[model samples]
Target: MQTTRLPHDGPEISVLALGAASLGSVYSEVSQANADATVQTALGLGVSLIDVAPYYGLTKAETALGLALQGVERSRYTLATKVGRYGDKAWDFSRDATLRSLGESLGRLKCGHVDVLQCHDIEHGDLKQLVDEALPALRELKAQGVIRYVGITGYDLAVLEKIAVEQQVDTVMAYCSFTMQDQRLGPVAQRLKSHDIAVFNASPLGMGLLTRKGPPDWHPGHETVHKAAAEAARICAEAGSDISRLAVQWALQKAAEQGIASTVIGSSSAVNMSDNVAALNVPIDAELLARVEAVLAPVRDLGWDVLPGNGGKAGS
Candidate 1:
């Protein structure tokens, strides 16, 4: 695994970060021992950044992560978690709520201060509130050495871009995958790079649609998204690469090509994690990339039409 410098002069982190959402019971249930083993395995594989949030599994993810890092050197890893959301629940951006969230997250992770603290999924209306209220507190914490950097993450690239332009945060995390499926963040990536703000892309696999199992209509919004995913899979197959590998490689390659800092992939099992890591080694030829793009050309929005709260239920 390669390491990249954090934006705003913070610590360096692994290019491939391990997302802790799957370690919790939201997607599937894992024994505490298994979670610990997975965390340890990721560390051994040179993955230094672990992303978790208090809302994941109702704080179970953070608890599991804390237990996993109990005996390890805290400085060896760059820890990150979010405030402004709670447990598959709703989003809240109040100043007092932000403080309360951080306190609880720190207690759950058993850490005095986190390396990076993010404002999770803040919308346009809440942006000013965040800058006015949360920003001061976060800056205070950073000044006191409680946190090294501040970041903002969300599914909407527009919100990310707005924050990156108006705020001086250390990093910004967005969702960008291969196939130009959602080009929403393309410009945002360039903007962040110019500002020296590290960008972390999540959902490289588009929420498991690029895997061997193909897409599923898990929810109402997934109906059209699954169809688009299947089309992408077919196109990848015709081009000599599976959708799974292509999706991961597309993100890693694009991030490297564009000079973004890192991309995060969520994996529940060690086998799945290994498969994702193997994508870093897969060779994506010009022909394959071209064909993949052609196949995805017809669906420019790429099912973002069904995104939650956008008059659809994708994220819901």
Candidate 2:
């Protein structure tokens, strides 16, 4: 496992991180034992960033993670959770809601304070409110020792950059915008680095578009995007490799090179999580990657939010 240091003297964390959305059963139900193993296995593998959310599994994920982390040294990892959005349609970036959300998350996580506190899914929240109320609340918490650092997470790269630079936060996390197929975050991340703000990229698989099984029906990518990914998957398979493996390795390695401090991957199965870590060790086939890149050429730098027919916020 490789590591990268956060900007502004933040703690060094693993380049690859563990996402707990699956443990919360967002896609499907996961047994408690499996969830525990997934978190523990990631830790044993030297994963230092564990990201969860109050909206995930409606709080089940945090509770499960709390139990798994019991007795585990607090210094072993950086814990991150989100505020603002608490459900699919519920969003509150107000000062009161943000404060209440953090309190609930801490109770569920069984931790005195989280290392990083982020404003979740800002694309859906009222931006003026986030800036006027939510961020101030988070920074206040940071000042009071309730959290060490403050950040924001969203799906829009441009907005992320705008807020990161304007608000001057510790970090910014954007998903599905930094994968091999969509490198839109590269330039934005570079600029953010100049501000000494650490960067995090989630869903390097484009939230499933880069997977072999293909994007789910709810995925917002156009049909053309799906076809391109399918061809890339086939090309990798013919080269005796899996697209998921290449996708993970490409995201982690590429992110590290692009000034991203960490990339978060979500999975419920412990075996699957370990396999992802192992995939990083297997050298990425250059020719195979090039071929896959060619296959994905048509949709290079694409994002569902900006794609036609998408709700602009769905499938992220």
Candidate 3:
């Protein structure tokens, strides 16, 4: 239930922000009732930041969240959604498209304006366009009160750092790059922090690669990395803990230590949400953490290619 303040004069948000991709049914179907319960439970547990995107479940997540948030006081939590990348293959970050996306997102989320509006998956688009056209559009919206904070999200640490430093935005959400497996975001995050830009680390579970269930087929990690993750999960299990719990706790605690605003995570199940919050109270087992790291030593930071601009592999 802990919270962190966003740098650069942004609002305070929960250290454990709710990720809505699960409600979007990214890997599995999520019922409306379950989605509602998940959001409610997170709020009940004092989570104040709910981040979603139109691309998630093709707008299903936003709609579900809007319904759940109905009748609830809007000031109880901070909302964030993204622009660009409407589908798996569709991406447009032009000024017109960005504005249109924000309009559609506000409609789906049933909110007047988002506390944070970020450019979604910028690595998939032309970075030059994002800096040249998309960011200015977001800035205009921010000036118009449609977006309180302007930011960008991507997987490439180098490009993200470039944007974060150059754009002079409020925040950046980087996924799967700041996990226990890959602490590559430390330097880049520090640079952003120096610029008063808050850092939001998403997918601390490493896109399911750090869990006992292992990475799904769609996960870009190589087979060897998956095997290493399996061993790491087993190590945690042998210590009478679940990898998911360790993973989330690690990310949350690490972010807090680093002064990062929040670690974004997603789950459609209320039980999982409760369990994750509960894990925050449990102390980090250093020996257990070290053992898990040892198991993942071989493939540490060795993930499949997900970076843009160069089609290069990340966590290398």
Candidate 4:
């Protein structure tokens, strides 16, 4: 596995990081044993950065991770979890709430403190309060040695750019923007680098929109987008390749070209975990990738609807 040091003095983490939402069972129920196995598999593969949130499975992810890492030394991996929204619609960034959330996350992860503490889903919260109250609180926690890095996660590229320039964050996570269908994240890489803030792109598969199985029911992509994705898959299949495998490789290569520190991916099954880890070693076939990209051109940059104030939908 390859590793990179986050720009702006952030910790060194694996280029292919583990996302823990599956352990939280966002799309399907994952047993505790499966969740434990998943984490162990990731660690065994040399994945050092693990991202989770209190919102995922409403704390199940953190608890499962805590149990999985029970006897493991903390120094072996870098832990990251977010605080802000507690549920699908619940939004809270109050100082007291942030403090309490951190304490609870610490307890749930069975750790003294986290390596990275981000303001979760900032686009869904009051921007004023987030900039005014929440971020300062995170900085305080960093000062107290509770967290080593501070950052924010959101789906809106514009909003993330705003935060990167105007606020004091060490890193930023942009999802669904760095996939094979959309390369929007490349435009903002230099901007973030200018601020010395590390960049982490999540959902390289476009939240499953770039895979052969297609997006899940909860995915926000429209019918046209789904159709385009299916076509993209067919293009790959015709070339005797798997679209999901190509998608992961493309995203990883793009991240390296753009100087992204890591890409976060989630999976519950060990087979999927092994495949994702293995994808890094697969050479990119330019002709096949170009064909796949051509197939998805119709939906290129065609993102889902943004919920007015609740952060732009996927690919936004």
Candidate 5:
């Protein structure tokens, strides 16, 4: 596995992070034993960074991660978890709540402090509250040596840009993928690099649309998402690359080219994990890259105009 340096303390993290969302059973049901085995396999494969959230499975994910890491040396890996939301409800950024949240996360993760602590799903409203209330608490924790670094994660590029410029965060997690089509965060990513903030590209496979077998309609999710998946499949076929491999490779190569430090790929099965890890070694040529760009051109326009406020629909 390739490694990248975190801006805070220069700790080398795996370029491909293992997202623990699936372990929480957000996408599908998973047993505690299965989640533990998944984490063990990831560590065996040299993946050091594990991303989990309090909201995932209402803290089940963090608990499972804590259990998986039990008795393992703390220095062997980097742990990241998020605050700001709880149990799919409204956002909360109060200082007291933030502190309590961290305590709970620390207890659940069974760690004295996490390497990376992020503000989860930030948006337009209450931006000042985060800067004034939440971030200061995180900074205080960092000063106290409870957390090594603090950061933010979200789908809004504008909000991420604002936080990156003003907050002095050590890292930023943003959504990016070849199936994204619109390439919404390309410029935002460049700006983040300019600020020396480590970048983690989330949803690199567009939430399994790029990797799953068959076309988009196979999934019973949103129509727009399925449509985008279909278009991505066509593009991959044109490029003579498997859509899954193409999607994963595009994210990895694009992050490398754009100076991103890492890209997180969520996996539920060992076979899928192996395939995704393998994409890091696949050599993509210039011609195939161009073909992918061109094939996605038409679908990009369809997704560009629909913003998140429009029902929080997928593929936008």
Candidate 6:
């Protein structure tokens, strides 16, 4: 596995990271046994950065991840979990809430402190409070050695770009905007790299849009977006290939080219875990990738609003 270091005196991590959303059943219901197996599989494959959130499965993700990491050396993997956005629509970024959220996350994760503590879905919260109250609280936690680094995660590229370039956080993770079907994060991540802030691009499969089965039923993408993805999947299927493999490889290659630290994808099954790690070594066929990209051309950078009514990159 390839390795990279975070900016501003952070830990070195594997380029392919593990996302714990599936462990918490954010995408589907997963048994604790499967979650445990998945975590072990990720560690076995040298995936060092593990990203989870209190919002995923309403804090169940953190708990399950905590159980999975039990007895493992704390130094073996870099732990990251987010605060705020506790539910699908619940969001609070007050200083007290931020502090309380981390406290709860620490308890749920069964750790003294997390390596990376991020403000989750900042665009969904009051921007002013997030900048003033939530961030200051996170910095305080860092000062107290409760968290080694501070970061932010959001689906809004504009919001992430503004805060990542101007704020003091050590890293930023933007999802669903950096996949094979969406290349907007390429230039944005480049600009972020210039500022010495590490970048993490999550959901390289575009939150299921770039898969053979297509996006989930609840996906906020447009009908046209789903159709284009299905067409791209068909093109890959005809070539005896999986669209997800191509998506993961393309995103990983792009991350390396753009100097992004790691690409995070959630896996609940051990097979999926191993497959994702193996994807880094697989060669992406240029002709096949071009054909898939051509099929997805119409929906390039087309994203649905993660937080509807916020004027985000919806239908753009």
Per-residue lDDT for 259 in model 5?
77
The superposed Cα distance between candidate 1 and the true structure at residue 233, in angstroms, equals: 2.9
TM-score of 6: 0.95
**Collision pairs in model 1:** 55-87
Candidate 4, residue 77: lDDT: 95
Alpha-carbon local distance difference test for all models: 0.73, 0.86, 0.82, 0.84, 0.75, 0.85
Q: Which prediction has more favorable lDDT, 1 or 2?
A: 2
By lDDT, is 3 or 5 better? Answer: 3
Judging by TM-score, tell me the better candidate of 1 and 2.
Answer: 2
Displacement of residue 228 (Cα, Å) in model 5 is 3.6
User: Which lDDT tens digits does candidate 3 get at residues 22-70?
Assistant: 8988868889999999999999999999999988888898999999898
Residue 15 in candidate 4 has what lDDT?
Answer: 93
Which parts of model 5 have CA positions greater than 4 angstroms off? 177-180, 213-225, 234-241, 285-292, 301-316
Which pairs of residues clash in candidate 6, taking residues 3 or more apart in a chain or in different chains? none
Clashes of each: 1, 0, 1, 0, 0, 0
Clashes of 5: 0
Q: How far off is residue 310 in model 5, in Å?
A: 8.2
Clashes of 6: 0
Write the number of the candidate with greater lDDT, choosing between 2 and 5.
Answer: 2
Model 2 lDDT per residue over 1-316, tens place:
8998876677889999998877887667888899889989999999999999988888889988888888899999999999987877788999999999999998988889899999998877899999999999999998898898889999877788899899999989888888878889888888898898988998888877787777756676777788899999988888778898899989987886788989999888788789899988988888889889998988887666656534433423
Residue 34, model 2: Cα distance from true site in angstroms: 1.0
Q: Write the per-residue lDDT of candidate 6 for residues 183-239, one digit (tens) a residue.
A: 888888888888888889988888778888776666777787788889989988999
Model 3: colliding residue pairs: 301-315
Best by lDDT: 2
Runs off by more than 4 Å, candidate 1: 87-89, 176-180, 215-222, 234-241, 285-289, 303-316
Give the lDDT of residue 148 in candidate 6. 87
CA displacement after TM-score superposition, residue 248 of candidate 3 (Å) = 1.4
